[model samples]
Target: MATNDKQPVDPVVRARRQRIRRKRARQSVVFGVLIAAMALAALGAVAIYNGAVSMPFARGFSSTVIPADDPIVPACLVEGKEKPIGYKKVRVRVYNASERRGLAATTAKSLEERGFTILATGNVKTGVQNAKIAYGAKGVGRAYTLAAQIPGVVLQYDARTNAQIDLTVGQGFDGLIPEDEVKLETGVPMNNLPGCQPLAELTPAPAPASAAPTEDATASS
Candidate 1:
């Protein structure tokens, strides 16, 4: 009689097979998580390229603290001539045909409050009834000279007319000419006038003295 030959089924071998299957399932879960992370990164990149998401970044078109339209007032009228005076300083030149006199002082307090300084004054003995006025700084002498050349704007004094000429410099000069006339010259240079003195250094007023202590109060103390 031939007994049926059969292979023995070991319990230890079956347990090892079950552990291997569980490890493969865990590996599959880890790989799926890695693939999901990569897809999310790609989606973010595509959204940025399509303008679906806004990235806040700095640009050159931003506004600044200082405005571009602001006006600048010069510190000194002429170089080497920065002298402070009371509000409204002007140079006055009084001329009586052949004889000329120059005086610089505070003409109008209102004008001084408005940031206007008189740099120089000249008196020419022409026969016209109205006096000629010229306004200029150290760098813009030619502009003032060109303005003086204009007819009617600069008048000659006449002896026959009993009227006196009153010429003023400052804000009035700015309005008499075009805006381009007030600019500095590029080609021809300007020569500063000689014997020019600062308004503060010319002649100053005396300062007041402090009040003296009372004799009665001193004795009581």
Candidate 2:
């Protein structure tokens, strides 16, 4: 016979244990709901924002926008366009191939006055019949820009060093166009590209052997 020394369980103790168990279960359920809600919110945020534009925090309203990796849109009022020829980057030399004295100096002076970096001015041994714009290596477009400076000029493709373009004044040379008439003839987006004009060969070819570009000017100076 075992001695039944253990008294009946206290009703108060049992009730307290039950209450604590119920409270613990409610707390677990609440914590699980909170975690699920947070996860869903994170997924929703990712799905909503894609690649329409960069992060909105990166810029501000009604303020000057910063440049980005890709070229800026024209509407952005930013100049991110790629130019085939940058005028300031190329070296230009003006040589007087014309019989007229001081034509080289005058041409060089004119160019210098109009934002051109003049190297040196001198005279050619044999004055050409038509003014020639000679370029070496990747100076064809620069040649075109040089050709544009003066009217009825020839383009000569020659291999030279240091000088990107040579302005050889010729017999037909009168003077640099009036400051108002210094428009460069360009059919393409950039002047460095080859158009229809055949490069300078001889005087009086009538038309260039290359593509014939409509004689349109690009600048006033």
Candidate 3:
């Protein structure tokens, strides 16, 4: 009986109400899609930050490689008269080959005082009667430069590929020759040793300061 007073709903109003419902459903679907998209974006950012994913463009870049030592023959090897290579240019690593304690360090200090570039100080198993100046073909002049300092020093050539000279202290090593007694001719070109090898035929040592860890002969811990 109460329902008899109510009018029938308008068709246009019904259609509008249906359209509103459809719009709300579409909005809900769009919001859910947006949330999913945001979550995926966040995951992608995390992956990039963690280095799990890399940008395609970034693969084009790379780190620079250090160039090898230049193939240069010592001037003394090529020319009969060569300008003296200063102690500063000559690199030396001292090794104690005898029972003398701290001999390498003491000898390095002495050489350093005379403006020599002492790379390191350590010990070697090989024994010598007097100090032995070991050198590679690239360090012939450098070896001679060190030989000028130590009295009764002997030269021993090796297959090293660097210009670094090794000064091995021996049992008979007293000290560096007196500064006054060390006579280097002034304004005179240094003469090459007799029967010197062709520097062009030998491999060059690593550049200064780029010596490998395996090449190092550091003091025993």
Candidate that scores best on lDDT: 3
Residue range 1-221, candidate 1, lDDT tens digits: 99979888799998899999999999999999999999997997888789897656735574533212112121123454323332223332222221212211222222233434433233333343322332222222322333232223342222212111234332112223332453334343434334444333333223112112112211211
CA RMSD, predictions in order: 21.0, 19.4, 18.4
Candidate 2: C-alpha lDDT: 0.55
Tell me the tens digit of each residue's lDDT in model 2 across 1-221.
Answer: 87879889899999999999999999999999999999987776676576543554665564733221222111100122223344565567666554566777777777777667776666655446556665653565555555556766656555454346667665566666776775643343433322333333312222223221122111111
Please state the error at residue 170 of candidate 1 in Å.
32
Structural similarity to truth (TM-score) of each candidate: 0.26, 0.45, 0.54
Q: Looking at model 2, report the run of 10 residues with the lowest lDDT sum.
A: 69-78
lDDT rank order:
3, 2, 1
In Å, residue 86's CA in model 2 sits off its true spot by 4.0
lDDT of each: 0.35, 0.55, 0.71
TM-score preference between candidates 1 and 3, better one = 3
For candidate 1, the clash count comes to 8
